[model samples]
Each structure stands twice: as C-alpha cells, then as structure tokens.
Target chain A: MATFMDVHRGMTGITDEQLREAHAADLAIQDEEGVSFEHAWADPDSGVVYCLSEAPSPDAVQRVHERAGHPASEIHPVPLAV
Target chain B: MATFMDVHRGMTGITDEQLREAHAADLAIQDEEGVSFEHAWADPDSGVVYCLSEAPSPDAVQRVHERAGHPASEIHPVPLAV
Candidate 1:
C-alpha cells in the first residue's frame, strides 16, 4: 500500500461539522476499496481540502472520496515520506 | 496557530535520503518560528513534495523551508481539520 494526498477544490465555506461528517462518510466505506482516510485538512478560504490516506492505489483513494460525496481534483501518491 | 500544507514543485529526482535530510533541516530550525514540521510526502514522479506543519502563518512555514534549502512554491493555511 502507498500513502496518498488528495486535494478537493471548490469547498468554500465548509464548516468543521461538515468536514467531520464527510470524513466519517469516507471512513465508513473506505475499507471496501482498501483505503484508510487517516486525516483531512481544509482551507475554506481557498476552497481547497486535502485528505491524507493509505491505499493500494490512487484510484482506491479517489474511489473512497467519490463514494463519500467529495471527489478529489488531484490525487498524488506519496511513495516516500518523513 | 494554524496548520499549513506547503507544496514544493520541480524536485524531479529527489531520493528518500534527500527528503529525510531536508525534513531534518526543517526540524532543526522549525522551533525558531514556533513551527512544527509534522510530516512530509513526496511524489518523485510528479516532482512534487508536500509538507504538513503547524505554524503561526504560512510565511513561517515558507521561511523554514526556504532556510532549509527547499522553499515551497505554494503554502495554504488549513484552519480546519478532522
């Protein structure tokens, strides 16, 4: 498995409750795709949200996010980290 | 304090050792700005690097990366997370 950082754009005015709810949604169905949505951060002002996860592939991470209601605009594989 | 996600572009052939070394450099000086370089991810294929940090502002994050020798191209403040 590889870690990935996915970015979701155009999420302006996103509330903390909404962000948590969306994360919970991903967590609920991520297992089906062999993905784990570990954490997420958002800059409502920029209309951008970033999700960090571990998955078999970038597709798996996108699948989870798409299924959970917010499709990511960019999915970058994080093969190396520190 | 706010969490920030900074992106560095055009590091096409960055190796794991280089990534670690850069991160260590940031760590060595992060406290000077009251910033914490929590984690970093890189996609060598895409020539992109992402750093996650807690700092007073995006400028602080940028300063650390600049002094560490890998200034980020973009820095976004993540005021909300889950």
Candidate 2:
C-alpha cells in the first residue's frame, strides 16, 4: 500500500469532537474502498484538516473521504516518511 | 505543549535524505527553543512538506525550522486530533 496525505480546507470553527466523529464515519466505510485512515489532524484556527492514510491509490482515499462527506481539497502521495 | 502543523511548499526535487537531515538538524536545536518535532512527511510530486511538532508557541516552531533552513510557508495550531 502507498501512503497518502490529503488536505481539507475551509473547516473553520470545527471542534475536536466533530473531527473524531468524521474520522470514525470514514473508518466505518473505508474498507469498502480499500483505504485505511491512519491518523487525522485539524487546525480549527486555519480551517485545515489533514488525513494520513494507506491506500491502493490516491483515488481510493478520495473516494472514502467523498463518501464520508468530507472530500479533500488536495491529495498527494507521501513518497517518504520519518 | 500545543501541537502545531507546518507546511512547506516549493520543495520540488528535494530528496528524502535531505528532509531527514533537515529534520535531524531541527531536533538538535529544538530543545533550546522549547519545540519538539514529532513527525515529517513529504510529497515529492507536489513539493509539499508537512511537519508535526509540539511547542510552546508557533513562533518557537518557526524558529527551529528557520534555523534548520527549511522555513514553513504556513503554520497552524492543531486543536483537534483523531
């Protein structure tokens, strides 16, 4: 599997609880798209949310997010990590 | 400490080894500025680098990055996680 990092913008005023709920919702249906969300981070101040996932392709990750009603603004393959 | 997510753009052609070296350089001086780098991810295709850190303030995180010579384009407080 390849690692991908996706970004969501314009999420100002979002709460921690809301983000967790959204992540949970994605998890519930991720397997259907062959995607596994590893972690999620949100910056309410900047209205940006980042998700790191392992998936067959970036398209799979986007599919899961779109189905969860939180489509990402940008998606990129993480070729390296540390 | 609060968690901060910083983004770096226009890093095209940068290599994984270069990112790791920069990260290590930051770690070497982070304590002097009350910052701790948690993880880093890079998208070679997109020329974006993301760094997650715990720090007393965003400025402190920026200082560490600046000293490491890889200043971030944006920094946001990560108020939520999942």
Candidate 3:
C-alpha cells in the first residue's frame, strides 16, 4: 500500500465546519475518483490542512483537490515511519 | 494503497535530533518489515510524533514501533480528500 500525507498552507480563512462540510462531500468525490480518504485535519491557527489517503497515483490525489475547488499548496509524499 | 497517521504521545522530553536519529534507523527497520514510511514529525512541547506509512496490516506498523522502543499511541486511517 502507498501511504502519503498531503499538506496545504494558506488556509487561514477556512473554518473547520466549512472544511468538514467539504469533507462530507469528499467521500463521493473519492468514490468517483477511485481513491480512499482516510482522514483530514486543519490547524485553526495555522490555516493548514493535512490529508491522508490511498491511491494508485499522486495525480489521483490532485484530481480530488481540483474537483473540490480548493487548490492544495503542498501535496508532499509523506513516507510512513515503519 | 492505504494511508495512515500514527500519533504517539508522552514524548515531552525527547528532542528533534533524538527523534531524527530514530528516524534514520527507521528506514532499515521498515525495509525488514516490508513497510514503507512516508514521513514523521514530532512536537517538541507535546512529545507527540506522528508518522505516515504504508503497510498490509496495522500490526506491521506496530511491530516497527516495538522494535524501535517507542510504541504508538494512536493509529488512525487517514481518509484522503479525494
């Protein structure tokens, strides 16, 4: 399994409720894109949201963000500490 | 591919260098267990280290921690915002 953490910066204005709303809809998005969204979190002060997911390719991860209308700032490859 | 975020607490006294040292050793440990680690971060104040990784089972993830001398506090599947 390929595991990764994608973090986004400059989310200062977004609220957890708003993001959570987005997350509620995100399931369908993931289902449609063939990706599994495991969890998502945002720092209230820092305006950063971290997302973890499973996908065959990184492009699929990006596609989900694009469709959601919130462009990600840093979609880094988070190597798990196994 | 399945992504997960494992957060461990009670590390209040550990330093970044100390954790980084462990992380450096983690690669070889991962290779032996057939797990791939994407990244790890430690909170100096909170003593919490969050790790992201790819593995076939949750037990595999725990095995790495046991061998490393630090057990994980929480292992949650991170749903991707696809």
Candidate 4:
C-alpha cells in the first residue's frame, strides 16, 4: 500500500458536521476501491482540505474521493513516510 | 494546539537515512517551542517534503524546521482535523 495526501479546494466555510459527513462517506465506500481514508484536515478560511489515506494507487484514492463527491484538486503520492 | 502541514521543496533524491536524521533533529528541539513533529511524507520525485506537526503557530513550526537546517517553503495551518 502507498500513502497519499489529496487536496480539495473551494470548500470555504465548511463546518465540522459537513467535514464529518464527507469523511464518513469516503469510509463507507473506501473498501470498494481498496482505499482507506485515515484522517482529514481542513482550513476553512483557505477553503482547502487535505485528506490522508493509504491505497493501492493514487487512482484508487481519487476514485474514493470522487465517488464521495469531493474530488481532489491535487493528489500527491507520499512514497516515503516517517 | 493547531496542526500544520509544512512543505519543503528542492530536496530531490533525498535518501531515507537523510530524512530520518532531519526528522530526528526536529524532534530533539520540538519541546523547546511547545511543538511536536508528528510524521513526514516525502516525494523525492517532485522534490517536495511535507511535515505534519502540532504547534502553537506556523512560526513555531518554521522555527523548528529552520533550526533543523531545512526551512520550510510553505506552511499551511490545519485548524480542523478528524
């Protein structure tokens, strides 16, 4: 498995409830794409959300997010982590 | 405390050993500034390294990285996490 950090933009003023819902949506169907959405961080002021996940590939990560209705603007592969 | 994702660029071809040493340096002095260096992700292909930390402010995160001899190029505050 590989780690990924995906960024979503244009989510200004996102509330905690909304973030939770979105994360839950990803978790619900993550297994379909062999992805695990671990945690998410959001800066509502900047309208940017970062999601960390472990998946077979970046495509799998994107599939999970896209299906969850929050397509990422950028998906970065974190090949090395510590 | 707030979470931060700091970016360091222009570190292409960094080895795993080098990354560990750098992370260790930050861990050694993080307590002085009331910060905790959590985890780091690196994409040597893009020459970008991302460091996740809990800090009082972005300045504190940068100070630790700067002291570790690898100043961050960009630091984003992640005020909300789940």
Listed in order, each prediction's TM-score against the native is 0.95, 0.98, 0.52, 0.92
Worst 10 residues of 2 chain B by lDDT: B11-20
Runs in model 3 deviating more than 4 A are: A1-82
Top lDDT hit:
2
DockQ (Cα-based) for each candidate: 0.88, 0.85, 0.09, 0.72
Q: Which of candidates 2 and 4 reaches a greater TM-score?
A: 2
Model 4, stretches more than 4 Å misplaced?
none
Tens digit per residue, CA lDDT, model 2, A25-70? 9999999988999999998877899999999999999999998999
Which ten contiguous residues of candidate 3 chain A have the minimum total lDDT?
A73-82
RMSD of every candidate to native, in Å, equals 1.1, 0.8, 10.9, 1.4
Residue B34 lDDT in candidate 3:
78
lDDT for each candidate structure: 0.92, 0.92, 0.68, 0.90
| TM-score for candidate 2, residues paired by index | 0.98
Point out the higher-scoring one by DockQ: 1 or 3.
1
Using DockQ, give the best candidate's number. Answer: 1
- Residue range B6-64, candidate 4, lDDT tens digits: 88989898878888999999999999999999999888777788888999999999998
Candidate 1 matches the true fold with a TM-score of 0.95
What is the per-residue lDDT of model 1 for residues B1-82, given as tens digits with 9 covering 90 to 100? 9889998999988899999999999999999999999999999999899999999999899888999999999899989999
